[model samples]
Target: MPVIDFVTDEENLTMTVTAEFAAPVERVWAAYSDPRQLERFWGPPGWPATFTTWEHTPGGKAQYTMSGPRGEKSTGTWEFLAIDAPHRFEVLDAFANEDGTPMEGFPSMRMTFEFTPAGDSTRMSSTTYFDSLEALEQTVAMGAIEGTKMAMAQIDAVLQDLRDYAQGKGTRVELLDDTHVRITRLIDGPRDLVWRAHHDPDLVRQWMLGPDGWEMTECIAATEVGQSYRNSWAPVGDTPGEPFGFEGEVLLFDAPRRAVTTERMQGMPVETLNDLNLYEEDGATLVTVLIEYPDKETRDMILATGMADGMEASYARLESAVLTPER
Candidate 1:
């Protein structure tokens, strides 16, 4: 877990805060660009921010307000100075009246948000420039650094969810035994969303797509124990191969937590027992999927088919398609 780093250099009249997230560069940029996503974490832990008007264009304006736990309110406005997709943005931040009008004679701070690729993650660097050392010192003395750190800390969960939605490799595989395997993923979302993603047919079709150009055509699922469910997949276009489908029976069902299911492919010989477990940590979800094979040969055969890789892709699609919507 990476924390936000704050640097203040009053001599240069500049301040900076940087944080890293386990997500792609584009997703990080989206959080800042989208008003709804921005409202989710723009303020410190105690103060909640809401965006009333946001326009992501040069020369445009964004207006938001932060309300304290005891109902105190502070409004701020941003005048966009520059815009670059998925890389950087610059804005002039100013104190504003309740109606979003900038207060006269109040000094404004210019800030730039930068997103850079760090391996599979993104490093976000925000630099705020002040007109004078006095302004910088005044802002710092007003708990700017600590407040910024607190606000930046909220990006991790948001970025993780965005990453999972953008690229489906969030799931990891672990061999439990010769006849059993476990798949786990750190879902940067609530347990309920994850549960709905699995049980809801509309959401299931978003990420349960199989192979390239193949989409889930039919998904009928019921999580009640002993209930039968079926899913089918077909090519998006008229390509080679006929459509295939499978049916499964739920052995155990626990809403938003765990489930046990038995499944067999249309022409497969053995029935695979799958145990799905979801645990909540803070605001994130830990998903563990245990598959119990009847024998080592069956497990090996399934693994050889690149089962794990396919699931990763599917889950990624699920996150990006079902979890992250265009703002």
Candidate 2:
């Protein structure tokens, strides 16, 4: 695991964020150099950034907009001052008008991103210098520190995906609609093995545990159209509370290809339909879990639980627990 730390030097008119990634320098470099990959992590969780113009050369102009949950848009631009591949990039980053012009009242920032190799990992330090102490304080008050930290954590998952793809195990999660969310992963085995990993109580207990220090105390999957599955988890050590549990009735089951369930979480008032879609691609199992809530508010609330990130973490572990074993 990696941690992002923020530091401010008021006298120098700069704010710095430092974090070390588990990946090598090249993978970290590719994350920022590639526009597509950059878009994935340039913004925080609720807001997504789309880059319209990306030119890496010196003095090149890069334009992008980050869209809010309500479809509101915030535009920005990066004027490249320098670009040193796999090591550093310097730019004038600023909020901009819709047409790409720098906004009149906002201050532009001189930003520098430096990456260094540290024993098979990469150390990243990003510094942003503003014109005055007031400008720096203003940006910090505008959620810059927290947003950047969140974005960095997101890049962690992106890096893991890159590593997984190289090993024939990778997963992707995206918002499908207000009520539907989709998570897809490439499992390194046939459909049946993947199915057993999910449906077998013993294997399910092994891979589906929630967070650290929590273990599934019980697991049961009937695997029939009308039958139900249940799981209960509790703290591993001397924890005080009772175990939490959830159950779902199978809505559809097609052997090793697909299954659907209307799952009800404990203490929740709503039931969400989870469609488990599986298919074979390139001698691997492509698994997609589509969960649909009753409304946008409900779905958004669930997402705020950091469920997406947890799913990624679990799938990362699954590569070793089940996928790799069947490989």
Best by TM-score: 2
RMSD of 1: 15.5
lDDT of model 2 at position 222: 72
As a whole number from 0 to 100, the lDDT of residue 72 in candidate 1 is 63
For candidate 2, the per-residue lDDT at 302 reads: 80
- What local lDDT does model 1 show for residue 187? 65
Candidate 2's error at 134, in angstroms? 1.5
Write out the backbone clash pairs for model 1: 165-319, 165-320, 168-316
Tens-place lDDT per residue, model 1, 101-131, is 8877566999998999999988888999999
Count of clashes, each model: 3, 0
- Against the true structure, candidate 1 has what lDDT? 0.78
